[model samples]
Each structure stands twice: as C-alpha cells, then as structure tokens.
Target: MSESTLTSGAPITQLPDDYMQNPHEVHHMLRAEGPVREVRTPQGLKVWFVTRYDEVKTALTAPGISKKLMGRVRHDALTEHMVFMDPPHHTRLRKLVTKPFTARRVEALRPRVEEIAAELIAKLDDGDVVDLLDVFAVPLPVAVISELLGIPIDNRDEFRAWSNQLINVSTPDEVQAATSGMADLLYRHVREVQAAEPDDTFFSALVHATESGDRLTTEELVSMAFLLLVAGHETTVNLIGNAVFQLLRNPDQLQVLKDRPELIPASTDEFLRLEGSINIASFRYTTEPLELGGVTVPAGELLMVSLLAANRDPERYEDPDRLDVTRPVQGHLAFGHGIHFCLGAPLARLEFDVALTQLLARFPNLELAAEPETLVWRDSTLVRGLHTLPVRLA
Candidate 1:
C-alpha cells in the first residue's frame, strides 16, 4: 500500500493508511496509468475503480451498471433507500422527497439557516479553542435536517454517534450495532409521524406521500427517513469542515473570502470539488460485460467511481490541485451527476453559503489549533472528512 506500488502499474491491493487523509496522489497516478484500475478497497472488497472524469461520468449513467447490490441480502433498514436501488424503485422513492428539496423550497429556508448558523457561532467565544466540527459543522445541518423532518433534536449527540459508526465502522459487529440503533430510533419517529396528522414537514409528507395511489410502506418510510437523516447532514458537515480547513491552510484564500464575502456562495462548488464529503459514490455492480475507458470489466464485478479523483483529473481542469475560491467549478462531480444526483444538493449549498458567511464575518482570525498533519480523517472510503476540526475562534 505504499506510493511506489501505485507507480509499478500492478493492481493496487489495498489503499494506503492515509488514503482518507489525502487520496489525490494515488488518484493522479491511477489517472495517468489508465482510466480504470482494479483495486481492493481498505475493506478488502475488490472493485473496478473508475478514475478519469469522462469514464466516471459514463460509469455513473451506464445502462449495463446496476445500483442494486448483487448476491447479498438487505443488511439493514438503511439499505432499502434510493441510493442503493435502480430506476422505478429509485424513481419512486426519490420523487416522493424531491418536492421538499426543490431550489425554491430550499431558498425559502435561507433565513432559518442563517439563524441557525448565527446561534451556533454565538456560543463560541473569540479566544476559545474548540473542535469546530462538534460546535459548528456537525450540529448546524443536524438541526436543519431535524427541523425539516420534524424529528426531535434533543438527542442529536446520539444521532451523530450513530451516523459516525455507520459510516466509518470497519467491523460487522459495529455496523450491526449502528444500524440497529439508527433503525430503532428512526422507526419510532416514523411511527410517531404516522400517528400525527399530516403536516408540511418532510418526514410527515413522506409518511403520507402518495404517487398515483401508491404510498410508501412502513418499512419504506423508515428506510427513507434513515437515508434523508444521514445524507442530509453528512455532506454539509464535511463540506464546512473541509472548506474551513483548506482556507486555514491557504491564508490568502481565507483573506480573499473574508474581504469579498459575496463570493461565499459561488465558492461552494470549489470547496466541494476539492474535498467532497463522499470519497466514492455508493456501490454499483456490472449487470453485463461493460467497456469503460477502454477496459472491459466482466459482468457482476463490483464497481466504484472516485468522485474526488475525477474532480482533479488533469485532462479536465487547468489546475486541479490548487485551492482557488474564485475558480469556475461548474461541472464538478461532487454532488455527482445524472439521475442519481444528490437530492439535497440545494440544501447543502444553502447551508455552506450561510455557514461560511456567518463564520468568517464573526471570526476573521480563525486558525487551526492543531498541526495540519496531525488532524485525523474519518476511516471510511464512503466519507472523506475529519474526525474533528480544532480551531482557535479569534
């Protein structure tokens, strides 16, 4: 798993220990060698890793590739949601929740989102050294999603713990525990929503959502809730954390943002391109022999698209590694592409805009409390984010 192994052109057996901390070096090598490479994930699952931008896009939308997990039973309630399904089923589940996250509906939430950011920032004193993820990044989106879904935020810490375990846990026992805890908590909430009168909240709507006389079953309701709960906040948490971390590392970029705060919204995509929350899109399997990037992947092999890698492909961007907040980053695959594009992209963008604006306005002298190299990233290929972000709020 050393860097030299990547240079040898032999298939990568396992990812380096620091892959989560920084994957671009490996991405660069793989992109240069070929468009696709066979690699065993840190989890020991072999997959056809799609690296180059064009091929990644093709793999994302290819008819021969399937989103459904092959030869495995549904592991938990979370597995039943849209991210793991193909069309018709994915279409149905996604349609039921799409209206609530539309651009107009999300824009209407701007004021509330601002208020949430302000309230959270208000609690931190200028001189205090705090783990920004816990104090700011993690809670803001959790609150927004909780309120939107009409779920109680009183147990947010527990929610955060459940999310962390489910995303990063390496062992089956841990995964089972996290899955059970999330399923139990969400099932109770879904039942409560079902008992109450239909309301405007997203969860309530899902509980009562209908399309052409078809309604979500109880299991489907709970599973959908689980997906929204996790997907809603997870991306924003890392987006905010990673953006701040990058700005701190690049002081000039930080100053530029502080001086011209109007650029905050536009910079969201740039941040996403540099350090998106999800490293790899969810799992896919080939339904038939497929040609991607001149490589023929056999039928039924596991497939994964490296979004972080594709965003930095030299063939695509003029300067892929540099952090320039003003750069035009329109077509980035951070929120993914095609029909499986993130349902919460609008909300995630709105949150990033508000969070960064309020944060820089309040503390212009923010800096990392720990050495840059000392910060630990979460140990999950599915998520690319720090375990904590310690910052001096000056």
Candidate 2:
C-alpha cells in the first residue's frame, strides 16, 4: 500500500481495489482489528470509516453526527437534498414529505406499479438480449416516481437526465451545472404547479404545505424534489439491478424463487443484505470529539460508515460471502439505521417485491448475456451497482 499520507496510525486512507470490488476481506480485517479507524482520503481529508456492526449501530444513533455536513468539507453544488440535514431541521423537513413514503402510501400505488412492470415485460421481444438495468430496472423506479409526483410524462426524461448528471461524479463545473439545472427544473416545475390549481400529487402536497401554515421555503421544496428524483430512483435502481444479478448468479436459488413465489418478500431482504445497493452510509460529521473502538475522531470531522463493509463483517454475519436467498437478514444497514433510516424503505420494498415477483415469473429462464466478471461495475464510491446489466430472457 502507498505510504500513509493523511492520518496517524496504520495506513488506511487509500482503499484497495478489492475493497471496492468486494470488501468482505478488508471488512473482516476491520472486525478483527477494530471498529472505527482513522482513514484519509486521497484529497487528504481525515475521515473515520466505521466497520464493525455494533459500532456502526451506535454511530448511526449517536448524537452530534448527521448528513448535514455538506459544504462544510466539500462545497459541492449537489448537496441540496434533505438527507444532508440534522435534527429538528431534519425532522421538520422529513415530516413535510414523510406521508408519501409511508407503507400505506406505497401500497396504494400497487396497481400502477404492477401495471408498469407488466408494460415493461410486455415490451420484451422473444429471444432478444436486453440491458435489464436500462430497460427494466432503471425505468421502473423513474416511472413510479414520475407517476407519484405527478411529473408530466413529457418531463420525465428531462428530470431523469438531469438527476443522472447530478449524481455522477463529474468535474466541479459539470457538477455545478448539473445541480443548477436540476434546481432550476424543480423550481420552475413546482412554481408552475403552484401557480395553477393544486393537483392530487406530491408536488401539490408540498405546495399545499406552503399555502397552509407548514412554512416550506422554495429552496427546501426544490431540495426535497431533488432528493426524491436522485436518492429515490438512484438507490432503488441499484437495488433491483443488484438483486437480479444475484439471482442470476445462483440459478438454483433463482429456480427456488421461481418455483415458490411466496419467498419474494423474505428473499428481498436477503438480496439487499448480500447485494446492498447503497455501499456507503449517508455522510455524517462529528459534532464533538468522539472515540469509537479505541480510535479518537476529533470534533468537526467527516466520517463515512461503510454499509458495504459493516453488513459483511464476520462478527455480525456468518458466511458473509454466501448469497442464500433464504438467509434470515436482520440489522442490515441496507436501508440504514436510526433516525436517518431511509424514509423510502416501504416504497423501495414495494418496488422490489413487485418488480422481482413479475420479473422472475415472466422470464423464468433469464440469464446473464455476459460473463459475471465481464460486466462493468458502476464507478461510484457511494453506491454499489453495475453500469449495465446485460441479460437475455431465455
């Protein structure tokens, strides 16, 4: 490994390629050694990487840490989402939008979600190879979000294109341009909806909140819209893609699911645990000097809990490498933990359940078109997913 350039103690800044490809090995090392370790970024930022399961649970619930540390460390223009906020403010912000993400709300969309799944499946031509990620996985979530938010059918493509640019790691200027473009789109769309009569949709709800005594600022509304578009779709897209890839990799397990469909819900959790979409926990900054697992992380420092690493820690899970669809998964940080737990968990679960159930039932003989090793992984430090999932419905 390269010489430790940033933090004290063992060399930790640079994560090995294997860590990105499959971090189980390094995670084992962390569990055996310690939970919280001082790591340095290539940019020389001193950050803490929480590795063990219990330690992560504590850190996630710990006071004085949150997703609101944006611009404090890296002043990126893409940090407008509510995921980057702390308590009272975060709670207030979340309340305005929480209703739409509740289980009942997501469940109410079942008919539409099932219809979208069927529509996508119906479009598949027999014996033709398809990039499932692009055609099936990606569009499903975007369409669902568009329908729920009442985004005009014509505007969905623009929202998607802008969201992709905003999330993809690009140059500062490019990131800024993407963020500005997304903000402009959301501001304009919300304003137009507000100027007109309110409709029965999420954007309308936010407008109603504003019209009432809720007091949601224009910037906050835009930020929430940005969050729904990016975080809402981006993570679910990865989850569906990852779960499909895992099932295909283990045809026996796939056959089992195909044979017995009742296991879809339980299998979804296992799929998330084995092939979690969000690799990194949302960003958190220390409010005070915090010591975890014997390492001291100073106040006002940036820290990233590796959900990818934590879930695979041998101390918490047995046979961490195995992808048994039947395995009972608990305490999985896939959706996250604590007050900042994913608000869209219910909706995500519904999408996965509906999408996966239909996907397997429709294309029972689905197989990867390319070798597993040949498939390109998305080059993202934040999310774990493939750039493309090429498959053929056999």
Q: Would you estimate the TM-scores of all the predictions?
A: 0.95, 0.92
Model 1 segments more than 4 A misplaced: 2-13, 70-73
Which portions of model 2 show Cα errors greater than 4 Å?
A: 1-13, 17-19, 42-44, 73-80, 153-161, 210-212
Per residue, candidate 1 scores C-alpha lDDT tens digits across 77-183 of: 77888888888888988887675566777898899999999999989998999999999999999999988887786788778878888888456787787789888
The number of clashing residue pairs in each candidate reads 0, 0
Best by TM-score: 1
Q: What lDDT does candidate 2 reach at residue 381?
A: 58
Every candidate's lDDT:
0.86, 0.77
> Which residue pairs clash within candidate 2?
none
Residue 236, model 1: lDDT of 95
Report the error of model 1 at residue 295, Å.
0.9
